[model samples]
Target: MQDVADQARTSKTTAHYVLTGQDQKLRIAEETRRRVLRAATELRYRPNLMAKGLRTQVTRSIAFISDTVATEAYAGNLVYGAIAAAAEHGYLLFVCETGGDPELEASLIGDLASRHVDAYVYASLFTREVQIPAELHFERTVLLNCLAADNSSPAVIPDERQAGRDAACALLDRGHRRAIWLVGEPGEQVLAGAQRTEGIRQALSDAGTELAGTVDCKWWPEPAYEQFGAFLDDGGDPSAVICLNDRVALGVYQALKARGRSIPTDVSVVSFDDSDLAAWLQPPLSSIALPHRQMAAEAIRLLMTDGALAEHPVHVAMPVRLRESIGPPRS
Candidate 1:
């Protein structure tokens, strides 16, 4: 530890924290943290986490990478769960954000690996194909709240497909036949839109119903409002609408209000991701409640046990959350 500290040009305290797992800087200045990290890198000093953890057999550091931490509806709860789980096992957490960039994910993982992070956890905003770099393989790494093509490995994701179907079914139960779907833009790699939309379609098929129209709305309100507004202006008629997520739902509400339409009477609305704002919406919005905290805790648990998950994967489905948004179609 002393050698590493000298080589890294960092204080002995900082070096010890870097090696012995004792840095809890809830209020440390960012520049001071950066300086310590830079010195440690310049020294080309590698902390032997294996040796330090040989007897204890656990270094207690889990690195988490997220596609978009800021946009998540339940990000705070997810972090709380992860932190609580880690604390239970005397472990710590280091977080990184990829901002939905796959290439950057590989790079960030590589950097964390150099620190000899004990394990890894990757969280994606939506399900998609992940290009895991061979150089970034770890003894324990779990995908949280998402999945990849390589489903052989352990992953923790919400049963979004079921959630979508249930959302549709809820609307159907309220006497809605014709429905509009405001879907998210299907990117080249993101699979959430396609899978979720298929689930909604399946529900409609089972009920001998179909969508009145479809509108592709990305993760913004203005675009969703514009796209949906055009469809409404074009005389498109639907008694109910299902939004991709809470974001899209907000836009749908605005568009309807702009056109002098009332919700649950002129046009019932249902959305996924029952975010904090969902309940705050006018009359509240009916949505699917994602198991964000539960999923996060489960992922940390799996990652901490040296990747020794059972042969079968664990998939937990969150329940549907009905609010005041849906009602019978216009009489």
Candidate 2:
């Protein structure tokens, strides 16, 4: 207390230590220590980490950043899991949301680096090609649930490849030979979409079957609707339709209904990501739910293990969830 320090003619911090004694391992006395702790809590006192870092030359805080997908519940789960895991390692997490702007993300990263974040977790939305800013680099960094191959940063991605394969195989096993992939915009920079498509294609090849057709939604509802209508008008009659992700599938479903086609009767539909709305679709959507929490936790684990980021990136893919949306091909 200020009064105690004034009376002792010493600094408040020094006065407390003088009273408590250096290297004293004894538990706090019921009377004084508790009162001091209570007062500190009431005052919302926080230890000055910068001052401490100056003394010790190490600050135990880490920065976790996502590229503007914080609003999406699925991506939010990854951030939550990463924060939880980071806490377990006695490190602080400073989170920054970049609103999907590459420039903003780069700026935030540079700012965090200047503050000397012990490490960094760069979370990106699923895209074809993500270009991490060349100005951003760190000794300890991990990409969470997305890919940034251009930067050569170690990344942790949900088993998208497996999810793609599983979705296709499920339909194939149910006696569907002709299938179409309702994909998102095929941007050269969208690694996740491309990887998932490759997985589906590979699975189909393994099963001695091939894709019936491919549809690019261009990531818009109206455009996807138009595309689907045109495809249907052109006799795009596949026994099954596989959507790249839940949103694209929703667009496809709408297009099918517009054409007076019912799911799994006139045409079977299967998709990926098994979003929150998937099961609640007119007739539950069959999808592969990415293991967001698991992937996030693993990223933290690799980050904290011996304080060394793995030399070779570790990829872990969880299996897909099989639901009723996928059924046998229409007779």
Candidate 3:
């Protein structure tokens, strides 16, 4: 600071004001500000952020605790969105994965709290109910793609019901009356499947139609393929199919083709998750987007806002991406 002040021929106070960007508030002259900046640049001076943080009692850092999102390929958008939003707010984000371990998560949270992070964000690769540790000590905390058991923290999750409704409506709008829903096995992690199923059923009922049936394929493409193939062998022919996810849709695609049926020509198809493969399919698949990035951004925004640390859960909407996979059923 003294070297910069001497080089710029300004008082130490003036140098401090200019370097800290408080000169504008202090009504310092613009020329003096420029001189201080120039001197600092020429001397390659860098502010000691650690010292500043210690003095101000603020680190301007956020700790992002996740359960498997860091390692998952398709769900990495959650982290990307969080990082982008945090950077825009001049906050650094430190990410740590827990792999769903309670002990590791508690340790990570304790360590970050000791570091004096400004906030904490707990993220999950999928939307589900999570049991937050009782001993966690962060004042400002948010959950991403998951909800706290007792609604103890603000949470952001995809609107799975809306996603399912949108998928079903897409097929209905394309003139398909009857449809089958291929879903994953029943479980807490896969709760989205049940919510989606309800949404699809509601949409179908509103349209004066009904779901032909639901097939449990365990969320695997191979199982979906085999099961759907058997459905075809049994002479099942629905005008449309609402797959629980894109992977199941892939199996449906293979089954339909194997049975000499063409997409949108014989049957229209709609699914969820709008994964990368949706567009790369032979005839691009129309599906509901997961809204991972939007959910993540909302989580950060909620954390940054006053009173957003309350136990209010936010449900982000999932959008539908239309493509060649959906069309009017065979005339």
The true-versus-predicted C-alpha distance at residue 48 of model 2, in Å, is 2.7
- Candidate 2, residues 8-28, lDDT tens digits: the string is 444576536544454144443
Residue 199 accuracy (lDDT) in model 2: 82
- By summed lDDT, which 10 consecutive residues of candidate 2 come out lowest? 19-28
The digit string of per-residue lDDT tens for model 3 on 1-331 reads 9999999999999999999989977899989999999999999999887678778878989888898999898999999999999999999999999988888988988888777788888888877888877655446778898888778778898898888788888887777785554445534457788788878778888999888776667787899899888888987877888888889889889999988999888888888899998998979999899988888889889878876365677889998899999889787
TM value for model 2: 0.82
Residue 215's C-alpha lDDT in candidate 2?
75
Tens digit of lDDT per residue, candidate 1, span 1-331? Answer: 5765676566787766754445664343456556656766777768766677665656768887887853565566666678788888887888788886767877887777766778877776665556554554545777776665666457887776788798889888988877555455644454656656777889998999887767876767888888888888988666888888888888888988999999877888998878886898996999987787888899887765642665445566867888888989898
| CA lDDT scores, all candidates in order | 0.75, 0.72, 0.84
Q: After superposition, how far is residue 83 of candidate 1 from its true place, in Å?
A: 1.2
RMSD of each: 9.8, 3.7, 2.5
TM-score, candidate number 3 = 0.90
Of 1 and 3, the candidate ahead on TM-score is: 3
